[model samples]
Target chain A: MKIVTCIKQTFDTEAKIVVGGDGQISDEGVNMILNPYDEYAVEEAIKTKEKDGGEVVVVTVGGDKAQEALRYSLAMGADRAVLINDPALEKADSHAVSVALAKLLSDKEAGYDVIFAGKEAVDDGAAQVPSRLAAKLDLALANVVVAVELADGKATVTREIDGGTEELEMALPALISAQKGLNEVRYPSLPGIMKAKRKPLDVVSLADLGLSAEDVASKVEMVSAELPPARKAGQKLTGEVDEVVAKLVELLKNEAKVI
Target chain B: MSIVVCAEQRDGKLSKVTFEALSEGKRLAAASGETLKALVIGSGVAACADELKKYGADEIAVADNEALAAYTTETYAAVLAAYIAQESPALVLMGHSTVGRELAARAAGIADCGLVSDCVAIESADGDYLFKHPVYAGKAIGTFKISGATRLATLRPNVFAIEESDGAGAVVDFAPEIPAAKVTVKAVNKVSGDRPELTEADIICSGGRGLGGPEGFKLIEDLADSLGAAVGSSRAAVDAGWREHAAQVGQTGKVVSPNLYIASGISGAIQHLAGMGTSKYIVGINKDGEANIFNVADYGIEGDLNKIIPALVEKLKEA
Candidate 1:
């Protein structure tokens, strides 16, 4: 088995997001980490490689800073990592990113049995890349997958739907987006971190993939970015429990008209 | 050009968000002077076309096929992309659902169009559409414009209102050339619950670690039942094994914007707030007065959830 997992670096889930004056999200003084959901993808890929005896290659598309994410994946047991860094990708949308990834994965020399990615990136929360990539490559895809098993050149995956779970079986060379409840991710050990420093990390650009900036240009443009309006604290009920409950119900029905 | 709404159905019944999307599609089409078309794809979803007509879909297209009985990325995307290729609609709309999130992107990719996911608002300025969506896990909002002939988007559930209007309800039989199945469905385990789905529910009652254990969910469920709300859980509760991951409402879980969100015993971590801060109204019940949940809540009740939840349930039942 040869596995490829796509990962991204995003702001910490708890980071307070601020939009700068230039209509861009300011990453200054913000903590960046591996996207929480992508951690599950990396962990699942490593586990599959450990059990099935294969090479796990992690890939990402971003600027030089994204090398940190690749290094982190390397520490987590990915055999090697590829960072598709390019200045033209600064304003890239999900489509542009997917185009670049499809190009990288389409290389016949680096053929793969399975591809994994986080269900969605926390920063943009687009959740579009993996499906788009799979479509561009004309491969089977399963999103929000929580369980996966492999046998006989095929993969069985259990994914979350609206009201329940669905079990799916796809042939080799399929793509899956990892959802939560998939697996418990392991923290990198000291030895693992040391070994990662020496692991092979390749940095490529759009030109290197035989593509120009125009070819992978973003179809969507961000007009503005701003923080959500602040919510003010409302009435606090601290009186007797029974009276408060009644008052709350009355408020909900009469004032809020929610009930 | 026309505006197309992809209506989703399960067991021949249209999802509530489908109606919402139809309503939005009608408004967009009226604004653009374009036709409003609704597409229903499934094994026995021809009946859904009637429902779409009632909700103001001028043209209802049904792609009834056994191959589309269950959603597979390859088959559904193939059908949708083929439809887009044939119709060449200016805009495509669907619910920001599990299926919609995957299907829209795949279809957009196959059709080589632009897609914006989880849109909360859409505005037209100078004949251009601007999509407003949350970024950084709902902490910030980004206004975007798609630079393409065909633009696709998924509207977040509950953010758009549903309005009924009679249309010509013209039926169009669509023949889709579905590709050979690359993925096969083995089984489906549908959760047996009478409560409304959390994402589509107008009212949601959520519990947290403060409730102590799994037994505490009984109180939450009772409250949810009395108010006809869906049951939700904070990540702590789910992590503690008191609830299913599907019930979790947080950064790593489902993001919901219900009309009313009642959170009990939840401390409202930033991640948790990211999932539900956009709700129209938030009610927090906690023993600690300084829990973060109170900051964003419209109504804060400082008391033990054990006492407040049950009392609220009884009061709601009487009302």
Candidate 2:
């Protein structure tokens, strides 16, 4: 089984999200981090390869600097890296990006039994790619997958819904968007990082995927940026623990009405 | 032009969030001087059309197919996108639900519009809609204008009150131009358990690092169980391995706006506050009076939650 994992690069969670004059995110001088959710995807892909004896390819749709994110993958343990490096694909919305990804996978004729991605991207947190890719490629998809296993030409997965999580059994060659706690993300060992540098990293362009700039133009654009208002700082009560607890109960019942 | 609101239904009943979307549609519709319409889709979900009409919809589009019998992104997006195109509503209001987020992202792509997910506030100023959403895991908020004639957005549940009205409405069975077969649902596997819906739970009890470990959290769980509330945790609690990230309510985790929120040992970092600052009532339990959580909480108890929680739970049982 060949597994393809989609990893996205986002500003580190701690970075100050400076909205530049153009209303786009200012990435200059900010520490970059892989989307937290994608760690589970990478982990799942490596685990899949370990279980079913297949190669795992880590791919992304980002700028040239995004190669560092791929390097992080190498440090951890992905077998290969494919960066769709073209000015055309940058800032492509989930829809256009998914179309480009589907076309890329098909053009390569990459035989894979399963494709994995995080439940959603961390930057926009749109959570769109996995399902949209499934629609374009016409494959089965399960979003919010917690448990996944492949066997005998089929894959069994468990995911979440409004009520709760349910188990599912479907045939192979499907897409799944993963969530956290599915597995523990592993760290890159010294040897893993060393080997990652020598590992094959394929760079694909939109032209090579047989796609055009127009096909990947974002339909929606960000107009402006502003911050949320701060909550009014409240007063704190002082007393013994018992008095504080008693006073707290009175406030909740009388003022907050939570009881 | 009229507006369309998608009312989500589950277990053969309309989700309370349906009212929230309708409430927003009601506001936007009234502002634009247009009637509000509702587009509803589910398996065996058409019976809910009449109830939706009373909420302010002038017309309801009911699409019931076995394929849609379950909530899959493929089936629901195609179904919703086709309906939005047919109606050409000025605004589309949807809940920021698990299904709503997935469906909204796809629909925005199909309709060629932008979506502001997990929004806390939507304001109409100078004939443009301004949306407020939390960023940086919840320490700060970002407001932006969606530049499009057809504005589509998903509202965070419970942030805005679900508007109510005595509007008269009717059901209209309309077929979309696109065939349902245009999309395929290869498989669906949902998690099934007795967990309450996190976003909509009126009362949420969350634990944090102060709880020590998984065993210590059982007391909080017991309190949550007695209150019949959803369970949540702070980033420290999740990092400490006391709870799952799904159960985390903070900036990096799920943002929630329940009516009543209880935090034990949560110091109320900006990220944690961003996720739940919109909660109407908050109770904090910690030993520090200067904890940031007290800044937003309606009430505070500077004490050990381990001793305070069992008593609170017992008090509730007596009441």
Candidate 3:
């Protein structure tokens, strides 16, 4: 069994968002880390390898700084990493990213038994890459997956839906996106971190993957980006507990009309 | 050219978001002077055609088949992609839902077009359609313009209004070839509750780690019952195993914008705020007066949630 996990680097969840004068999001002074959801995918991939006696390889599409995210995955027990970085990908939309990934995975030598990815990246929250990649590669896909079990060349997956969970079964060579509650991720150990520094990490350009600027050109253009309006300061109610509760209820009914 | 709205139905009932999508599609079509078509694909879903007509769709196409009784990404994407290929609509609309998020991208990929998901607004400026959506987990907004012959977008639920107008349209039967499913559905386990879904709820009552334990959710449930609202939990509460992940509200969880949001015993992490910050009116009840939840709340009650929530529940019941 061979497993491939896709990951991305995003601003730290606690980082403040700022739009610069250039109409672009400013990354200055912002701490960047591997996306939180991708951690779950990496963890699940490694766990599957540990049990199934195979290798876990991590893949990412970003700039030179993305190697930090690949190294983080390596430190978590992935065998190696592949980073596809190029100027053509700077403004790539979900379609372009998927095309690049499909090119890489479609190579004759890049045989994979299963693929894993986070349900969505926190930065864009597009939640389209996995499905789009699956479509391009013609692979079975299960999104927002919580539990998975492999047996007899088939995988049973449970995913979260609108009001409940749905169970599905797919053959091997399928793609699964990790949702939260899939598993608790483990922290990289000191020995693992030491070994990760020596792990093989290959950085390639889009041209190396048989893709050109025209091939992966973004279909969607970013017209503009801006920060949301700041929320107004709230009115604090102070008094006896019962009085405040009564006042709040009245306001909800008469003022807000929500009740 | 026409605007095509994919009407989603489950177990023979059309979803509320479908109506919202149709309403938006109708407006966009009227603005562009194009036809509006509603496509319904499911087992025994032809009955939805009449309802689509009432919502101002100029044409309704139903592809009723037993194979589509349960949603399999491949089959549904194939069906929708084939429809788009034949219709060649200028724009396609659907609800940004579990099914929509899973199907729209694959359909767009097959149709070889551009897609924007979870859009809060769609506007036409100088004859170009601009899609505005929250990026960086609701901390910022990004406006996108698709440079494609045909574009697709998913409208966030509850953000768009649903309007009804008496419309006469032709009902057509579409018989696109459904592809073989790569995945098979085995079972479905629905959460047992009559409360509205978090995304569709008009009001929501949420709990956090400050509630102490899973038992504390009892109070939150009582409050929600009184207001006919949905129940939500902060990531801390879900991580602590006090609530299911489905009920979690955060950047990694569900993003919602209900009419009223009550945050009890929540200290409001930035991630949690990213999910519910856009809600219309927020009420925070926490012991810490300086909790971050208070910053974005419309009304703040500084006290113990254990006492305040129960009192508020009683008052709501009376009101």
Query: Measured with DockQ on alpha carbons, how good is candidate 1?
Result: 0.86
Q: Arrange candidates, best DockQ first.
A: 1, 3, 2
Candidate 3 lDDT over A1-259, as tens digits, reads 8899989899998899998898888999999999988999999999999888889989989999999999999999999999999999998899988988889989822789899999999998889999999999888999999998987889999999898899999998999999988988999999999999999998989878877899998998877899999888689999998999998988888888877
Error of 2 at B119 (Å): 2.6
Model 3 DockQ, alpha carbons vs. true complex: 0.83
List DockQ, one per candidate, in order: 0.86, 0.34, 0.83
- The candidate 1 chain B region of ten consecutive residues with least summed lDDT is B121-130
Interface RMSD of 3: 1.0
Output the worst ten-in-a-row residue range by lDDT, candidate 2 chain B.
Answer: B183-192
- Give the alpha carbon lDDT tens digit for every residue of A1-259 in model 2: 7889888998787677776776656778999888878889899899888877878888889888888888888778888889898888766767677878888777684688888899876677667777667766767667787788788987788776665666666677888888877788998899998999999888889888888998777654555555545567555656765556566667767876776
Q: Report the lDDT tens digits of candidate 2 across residue range B1-319.
A: 7778888887668877888888888887778677888888876776798788767787888887666676666667778888877777767888888878777766765665656677777777666777776556554456656655777778888777776776668787765543343323345433324657888888899988878788878888888888788888998989887776678887557878898898988998866886788788788888777788888877777777788888777766665
Best by DockQ: 1
C-alpha RMSD by candidate, in order: 1.1, 3.2, 1.3
Q: Over all chains combined, what TM-score does candidate 3 have? A: 0.98
- Best-fitting candidate, scored by lDDT: 1
Residue B79 of model 1, lDDT score: 87
Off by over 4 Å in 2: A19-25, A257-259, B108-113, B124-128, B144-150, B175-196, B225-228, B239-241, B269-271, B288-292, B295-298, B314-319
Candidate 2 achieves a global lDDT of 0.76
Clashes of each: 0, 11, 0
- Write the residue-wise lDDT of candidate 3 on B4-122 in tens digits: 99988878878889999999988888788878998898888878888788899888999888999898889889889989999999899999898888899989888878999999999
